[model samples]
Target: MTRTTVTARPAEPSVVARLSALDRWLAVWILLAMALGLGLGRAVPGLNDVLAKVEIGGISLPIAVGLLIMMYPVLAKVRYDRLDAVTSDKKLLVSSLVINWLVGPAVMFALAWLFLPDLPEYRTGLIIVGLARCIAMVIIWNDLACGDREAAAVLVALNSVFQVLAFGLLGWFYLDLLPGRLGLGDGQHLDVPMAKIALNVVVFLGIPLIAGFLTRRIGERRMGRDAYEAKFLPRIGPWALHGLLFTIVVLFALQGKTITSQPLDVARIALPLLVYFALMWFGTFALGKVIGLAYDRTATLAFTAAGNNFELAIAVAIATFGVTSGQALSGVVGPLIEVPVLVGLVYVSLAWRRKFAVRGRA
Candidate 1:
């Protein structure tokens, strides 16, 4: 009867709620950035020319810088020392290889052919996009979706290696050999120089990866893991988003005139891309769940499989087909579509995360 008053524990705030204001309204900011870039490109004369003047292996230097800045902080956050566990997961490694190498390319090739049968350049461009896989921006997407950081790092590094070895061969197979076999070739062949692909991987993935690894090693050595993660990381985390937004603005501004002028063509290219992203993301996510992956690793797999290396795709298209070609245009249209779609997927992943938590409790 001297019964006690009991206090119930407070429920934790949801994942979305825990995000900082900048992180919370990411989709809105992305849209605004896209609009701003388009407006700048349309309103300002010679802006694209100015941005194009600085180049690193056919990629715009500003865009390259933005990518490095965008990727560095996220890579730095990864616990590199923990990657052995990720590597030991044979299921993850094998599944990723099959989906990325086999299913992803075949699906995009089919979609490109199905959607843009009349537009061969764009179709080829889409195939190139598919073969390049995701090495750069995928880390950001996976992190935002609350994925396993170490797993993402391992998978991304694995992708970079495969990209170097397989990109040219796969490009030849899809753009030349397979098309010929299917009687779909129009006598046009794509030759992606292996050296060019290797250079891109080295600059885009290697430089930042080395920088990030060194940063973490030195920071931890000096500050200890807790301080390095808790204090130092917080200071640099926002730059990742800043770099992403800046890159989006630059990309859109560069392509804004072409995008605005050729609405019909952009729409044509967009349809297949939309279908590709949705199918790849949802399909891989479902595959991960069926195979009994944790929510974090599942998200990593889904994002890695879904995102493309737009920089590599665009560079290869431009270097091979000229900047004014339809192939290049298709390449430019990639991130324009990918950014918004992946942002939506991030929300979807978070909602799924909530369900996972509920099921765990139940």
Candidate 2:
């Protein structure tokens, strides 16, 4: 009898390692977009005007289309069949909802009020941003943090659905009614057009969600699941990143004059936003710890809770206000601040996982 020795193969790189060049250098791309936008806005005379002219119902047609492109690929990756897991782990789902929908909004409102009381329009803009739950970028954050992609997808889908249903009502309640009741803003009417809000939701979230589902279903049915995942999905994935970069370029280009003109004013919005991201992230992280959630899920909750759906917020701001309005400027600043902060949190999550995560949990 001959004895054969079986040697183990080297472990392969992670699924995240397979991310496109755009995803890997997202921050750099954002910075490049900002620089390009500012230069174009300063150099070119009428480009912004031309882009703004392509509008419908207060939403810039070009920007709106760009955002939809950005969102569809992310939604297509969601495994809707695994949605039952969200209900099975009721604690995770409930805690995420409370933190994202309840505590998250309250904290942003307070910070925005405390910091920008004099600037009512910008304050209202920040409040609108707070109400938006992250439905797209959190997937990238979750992937980076080595969290459960499937669960993150479930949460993202849930957040998108909730945003469509609740964003208008919540905007009215918090920004208008509660602020009025509390004597926060001067007796100015904060008209949150329900129709615009709903339209933005439909265009950005609902359409993408349905399109993603259909694409995935049809692709898998024709090509089979293995080929669909390996070939088709990866090819289309880069388009989302491309859309994101292009959208950022358009947004900053539209508001470049405003941003470059009042650097200090724009800088002020960052104060409350920075504070909000840190506080909400750590607060949610603590909650996950208290509930004994595994590190992956905890990371998921943290990113989901802390991340803002800046695309929706930006669209709402531009649609409700004008393209270059202070409200729109506030929304544009969100991604500028959010990218670095969330990236830092990704490092923090990774470090904490290494130090404290239970054996075998990560």
Candidate 3:
């Protein structure tokens, strides 16, 4: 006799739904976390020394373990099946990809070269920082913006796979094109040749990515996807956050004097990041509306356009040039500015929904 197979039910609406994606408002939580972190770093300036020195096998724990915790959930959520769908939309994807990798990096390079003081090492680090396409955290922004989660998933996975290969050339271009802006032949700039950039990519991106994928597979086979996210994954976030907190504390402690000294330079780097985010947010929205995308699809495109994977920025920055270095420091500063900015953009998306009512209707 042949037996028929039964499909399991999807999870019922629970607190997650009740929270109304906006009400759950992870952006607020992230902002609050950063606020607490800043307060702690300042009030307890000495805490940074404690969290800064985590090493195993001559490598730091942030790349080794902290990054694994950060990326696992994204891997767990991957639906390779969705990517193969014949009805898949390409307009949104193409627009987002072009803007993110092409427009975004080029704009960053030009703007940084224009304004950033002549510090070659700093310039190279900044360029490497810009070359990377975001991977891990942008999804949260997508969800908050009420985006097309499926599309977001596909593109994020696709970008993560591609960024590993592209980062080297992009990193080189930032330095080579922005000559004199980076103070060529300076001690700091001189060290960041091509080979080091490649090595840093493998250490930060390759290792955590492969490990996260494997571990995500193991967890799924064991507990099922729903159970794994609700149970194991939430537990991991706090620990990862704790690791981040520790790292921040150490970073602040190490730079406690410098932060006081270089507040002006901090302002310069921050201005570009802020503008980059705003441009990406609005630029994507305008294109989506022009294309007459559906509400979810437009939101997905805008989120992909607006937000970035600053987590990778931090890890790569630290591994490549030491966390205390200015480039690394600027990379760390990204999320400090990104979280609040994206939350505000989510609100802006909601406000502008009416402009593209066709996209919003569905």
Top candidate on TM-score is 1
Winner on TM-score between 2 and 3 is: 2
lDDT (10s digit) by residue, model 1, range 225-306: 9999999999999999999999999999988888899999999999999999999999999998888777788889999999
Give one digit per residue, the lDDT tens place, for model 3 in 296-323: 5677777776666554555566766776
TM-score of each: 0.95, 0.84, 0.69
User: Over the stretch 175-236, how does candidate 2's per-residue lDDT look in tens digits?
Assistant: 77887789775433445566765665676667777898899889888999889888988888
Overall lDDT per candidate, in order of appearance:
0.88, 0.76, 0.58
Q: What local lDDT does model 3 show for residue 276?
A: 76
Model 2 poorest ten-residue lDDT run: 1-10
lDDT pick, better of 1 and 2: 1
Query: lDDT, candidate 3, residue 223?
Result: 90
| Model 2 bad stretches (over 4 Å) | 1-21, 144-146, 180-187, 315-325, 350-358
Cα RMSD of predicted structure 1: 5.7
